[model samples]
Target: MAEIRLENVVKRFGTVTAVDHGTLTIEDQEFVVLVGPSGCGKSTILRLIAGLEEMTEGYIYIGDQIVNYVEPKDRDIAMVFQNYALYPHMNVYMNMAFGLKLRRFSAEEMDRRVHEAAAILGIDELLDRKPRQLSGGQSQRVAMGRAIVRKPKAFLFDEPLSNLDAKLRVSMRGEIRNLHDRLKTTTVYVTHDQVEAMTLADRVVVINQGVIQQVGAPLEVYDHPINTFVAGFIGSPAMNFIDCRVVQDGPNILLDGESFQFPLSATKDGMQIFSHLLGKEVILGLRPEDIEDREFVKDQKEGIIKATVNMVEPMGANVHLRVASGMHHIIACVSPKTRAKAGENIDLVCDLSKVHLFDKETEKVISKSPITG
Candidate 1:
């Protein structure tokens, strides 16, 4: 396995910038994922590293070698694409062995590598089957096997499971993670799905509009987002943002808005930053899970606020509810036991310790508290 690095990487499509000043380092044996919305340059960045697309201006390094001048074959990298670009005429064994044949490996060497990779991918049983006979997941595995057989310095995956059904995608997610663990090959995977990025990556690179936004472990980025874009992008239902001005009343700092005015509680973790935003316009970010049904937090309650229920979404184990405190509409993930419904006013208390505060202009997180419950 080898480390990959991009320095001042810039890719342009005439007037439009596909990747802007992209610079990042992928450590040896690291599973790094590049994630963002479409037209965000994720695929272009991957192609730059794979030597598939030439950068307008930048340097890509594989290990200690600068690969800008190197051909894809000489770069020692294998890529698995969103579409399983398999040979329909060839069976699984031939498909996996084709790369080795192109490299002119001995017959025995090709057989050994093909079978080993098939075993690793658990596709040995389907070796004789053609791509037409295999399911979407199987075809994906074969695509991966094609890469694995090469024993390249690194692996590049571009939404390899996008074609599979939701159920199969979920199952394949686990399989891919397991495969990475066993192989421990330095890998870079690109996807727009936050769930896939969070679950599969050793480090997730959040990019937007051809620029790097944040790079961190999944939980680190989720808990401490750099800005509003990432705050809304990383989470499942996402954090709720409410516009309000701060009001200092006695020892408490209150957030006043058209709908409601509430005191901001200071937690031990965020006391340092909380002291700075005394009377300023700040955005309040609360996750759905951070706001709980009063009944659940009452018995094991920490901090609570009362509001009127606007809507309720029953999601199996918990109910997602939208509530209005004044003019502010917030979402809360409460216990399925919550009997409150729409058109009803209820006390919806938020775990203040779990709340996040961000600057209105910069959109940067100013303070956050860790919640145990």
Candidate 2:
């Protein structure tokens, strides 16, 4: 496996830039995922690395060699696409062996590599089945097997599970993770699905408007996002953001609003950051899970914000409640066992340590704390 690096990478299409002054180092044998919303250039980064799209500026390196001028074939990377791109007439074994045949490997070597890859992917039993005859999951396994047979320096996946049904997508996600673990290839995956990025990546690069917002472990980014964009993008149902004025609470800081006012705990470094925002409007970010149901909260915990329940969504194990605190609306997760109705006044306790404070104007996270508030 090779280490991949992009230094001051820039990709431009006419007057518009698809990737803007991006720099990142993907470690050897690391599973890195590029994630963002639609039109965020996640796919563009993948294409650049694959040599499918030339960069307008900067350098791309694979291991110690600069690959800016290298042809895609010589780069020695395998790419799996969202469409699976299988030849309908060919069976699984033939499809996997095609790349080796083009490279002119001996028939014995080709067969050995193809069979090995198929076995690793647990698709050896369906080697004789044509692409049209195979299920979506089977087709995906074949695409992966084809890439594995070549044993490239890196693997690039461009939303490979996107075409599958929800259940199949979940199953394929596990398969991809297992493949990365067993092979330990330097893999770069691109997806707009935050769930896929969170579940499958060793590290996730959150990008927006062709620029990287934050890059870190999935849970790390989810827990302590560097900006409002990341905190809003990384988690399901997204983080709850409410505007408030900062107020002094003894030596610490408190967020005061129309319906609620709670002291920000001194334990969180955010207190110091909020010092500058005292008496000024600041954005308060709290994840749905961070806001606990009043009944389940511990009194010793600091910062309790009260709100009126506005809506409820029961999601099997847990219930999601959208509550309004004065003019601001926030979502909190409640236990399914506890019955909650709309219009009910609910006490939503905010974990001060888990709170995220953002600059009202800059929108960047000022607090150094690494977990979701």
- Candidate 2 global Cα RMSD: 2.3
Per-candidate TM equals 0.94, 0.95
Per-residue lDDT of 29-102 in model 2, one digit per residue for the tens?
A: 99999999898888888899989999999999999999999999999999999998998888889999999999
- Model 2 residue 15 lDDT? 79
Instruction: Give the Cα lDDT of each candidate.
Output: 0.87, 0.87
In terms of lDDT, the poorest run of 10 residues in model 1 is: 265-274
Query: Candidate 2, clashing residue pairs?
Result: 223-371, 223-372, 354-373, 355-373
Backbone clash numbers for all candidates listed: 4, 4
Highest TM-score scorer: 2
Cα lDDT tens digits, model 1, 162-192, are 9999999999999989988988899999999
